[model samples]
Target: MSTSAGQPPYRDAEESVGDLVKHASEQISQLMRQELRLAQAEMRQKGKRFGRGGGLLGGAGVVGFVALLAAVTTAIVALDLVWPLWLSALVVTAALLLLAALLGLVGKKQVGKATPATPEQAIHSIKADVAEIKERARR
Candidate 1:
């Protein structure tokens, strides 16, 4: 007998218990693999965010050091000469400090965003899937 046009050949009117169990196993395995992939992608994204935050923080530190040096130079120049050069150095130092502050704030925000970097969505999905499986099994 030929199956209907809308149906596949393997999906008959009735399936054996073993076939059902095997299909369920395959489905569960596929689900696990998908969850794993999701978790890995999430972790990689979090890692990148963390790396960006760390780089920004390092830049802030370097800028802060430059600002310190500029301040010291400004003081020394002000003592040596009575001109606008000291004032210019002071302005540069202020600008560097502002830039460093901005970088530090942005880096802190990035790090905060990436904190507790767990695969939250994947975990929720897996939990929901398990709950659904349990509910179905009760029937």
Candidate 2:
């Protein structure tokens, strides 16, 4: 269809069809690029959140480790007054090792859970849009 009052005769159907196909292709490519950008942004956001969470967790773990060491030192000092120093030290070492192992396990689990925090909603939205576009094109 003519877009302006003084436009020439309308193009042939074949030319129009080619133009429509080209426009559709361009639109689809633009849409795909937009979707990719959205995905990248979402991934970067999720990465930042995970990085912050990981840093906090690491700090907490360090604090816990230091606290455990202090507790072990105090326990060994108190026990040494009543028992042999070597036995008290041995007991404190074993307790500290056990606490360290448990803390490590908990930290590992927390880190594992922090992965893939970005929601699948964006992907689903893109899929829905693609389906709708396909249906419209078919019609």
Candidate 3:
């Protein structure tokens, strides 16, 4: 029988089945590649955002350190009348050091939690797709 437009030509069942499997495999592979690329792009964007955030946090830490120094100096001048100047400076210096250490620890943890650059999700997706293709082909 003549095939109409938008219709597949009649063929043996085996042939039709093989063609279907081939087409599906090709489409799945294409989709898998696209997904991998998308994952890479997303990871890169996330890395950039994390870097920018880290930079901002570092800047804030520097500003805070400077402010702490200024405050300590001012307090030492004003309190020298009632307290030992050396004691005031020591206390302020210790507090500023502790604050710096705490900020460093927090920033380290934040950066550690950021998403990895590897396309793990895409890798998993492609693996699953391959298994499905294999299973279908076997049938």
For every candidate in turn, the CA RMSD to the true structure comes to 8.4, 4.9, 5.6
* Model 1 lDDT tens row, 51-136: 89889979997998899787777675764576477676666667777978998999799779866868998999999999999998
Residue ranges of candidate 2 with Cα displaced over 4 Å: 1-15, 116-121
For model 2, give the RMSD to the true fold. Answer: 4.9
Ranking by TM-score: 2, 3, 1
Better of 1 and 3 by TM-score: 3
Task: Give a tens-digit lDDT track for model 2, residues 34-89.
Answer: 88888888888888987898899899989987997798789989999999999999
Name the weakest run of 10 consecutive residues (lDDT summed) in model 1: 74-83
TM-score of each: 0.59, 0.68, 0.64
**lDDT, candidate 2, residue 41?**
86
User: Per-residue lDDT for 1-139 in model 3, tens only?
Assistant: 6667756775632467778778887898788779778788878987898789889989998998799778878877877777798877777678878978998999799768764557677778778877887897797
For all candidates in order, the CA lDDT equals 0.83, 0.83, 0.79
lDDT of 3: 0.79
Which residue pairs show collisions in model 3? Answer: none
